[model samples]
Target: MITEAEKWTKEFYQKRGWSEYGPFIRIGFLMEEAGELARAVRAYEIGRDRPDETKRTAGELKRELVEEMGDVMGNLIMLAGMYDVSLEDMMEAHRKKLTERFKGETS
Candidate 1:
């Protein structure tokens, strides 16, 4: 699943000349997207804190959360590419580390 997305992410950036933007730019994007995701998550589940954003319906807020999540993931994939890191490898290592750390937690 992540492998396919990584390939697509590389191509997407290359085709748009965004690959030249470098790792720092991608890092900046990741930070911005993460913040957006935080706000989206809060808005969707806890109702809006700001007056202007209050009009959005639950469905709209949920969609916003989903979109922000996609943005965050896409940025992460691109940043991984910048560092020559494969998401598949990242996934495997993550799985190994967590599995070892919490040996009997899965239910």
Candidate 2:
């Protein structure tokens, strides 16, 4: 089944006429998405580390994290769409690379 991420990504490209762009543009978009994730994580940390921090509860932190994660996922889906990539395929490729890096005997 196509996910919301897929739908958003398709709309994003369709609205722009699916113009071809350099790979670097996608890389930049990924970086921006990563930054958003980092910001969310930092917010969670700050919300958790409070001497007298009773303002934000854990639930609030979780909500913020989820929102940030959604942003990350959305951006990733958009980037993958831009490059005609499948997330499942990308994950499999990533797993293979990681396995080779960590499990391969050859130095």
Candidate 3:
């Protein structure tokens, strides 16, 4: 799935002429997406009112949060692709690092 996402993002970026952007630019985008995700989390927890609605429902907030999360993940995938790193490999390395660092600390 990560590989497929990377492939799709690469083509999508290229189609939009964003392929020329360097890792620095990609990182900026990733930061923006992270901010959006944070905002989504806040809205999901406390709720927010749209222009047409007095307040959003929990389900609505959750759906928006999921979309924001996807945006963050997509940006992350793009940034990693810029550095030729695979998300799948990164996840594996992260798991290994935590396993080694924590040992049996986790129950």
Q: Model 3, 74: alpha-carbon shift in Å?
A: 1.3
Off by over 4 Å in 3: 48-54
Backbone clashes, each candidate: 0, 0, 0
Output the number of the lDDT-best candidate.
1
Q: Which candidate, 1 or 2, has the higher lDDT?
A: 1
C-alpha positional error of residue 68 in candidate 1 after TM-score superposition, expressed in Å? 0.8
Q: lDDT tens string, model 3, 35-84?
A: 88898898888655558656777898899899988888877877777677
Q: Write the per-residue lDDT of candidate 1 for residues 1-107, one digit (tens) a residue.
A: 45777788779878988778877888998999999999889877876677664478888988999999988888888888766778787888899998999997767
The segments of candidate 2 whose C-alpha lies over 4 angstroms from its true place after superposition are 1-4, 8-30, 48-54, 104-107
Model 2 agreement with the true structure over 1-107: per-residue lDDT tens digits: 45666887668766886425555775776688788778768868764455775667678877878987876676677677666777777888998998888995765
Lowest lDDT block of 10, candidate 3: 46-55
Give the C-alpha miss distance for residue 90 in model 2, angstroms: 0.7
TM-score (C-alpha, index-matched) for candidate 2: 0.65
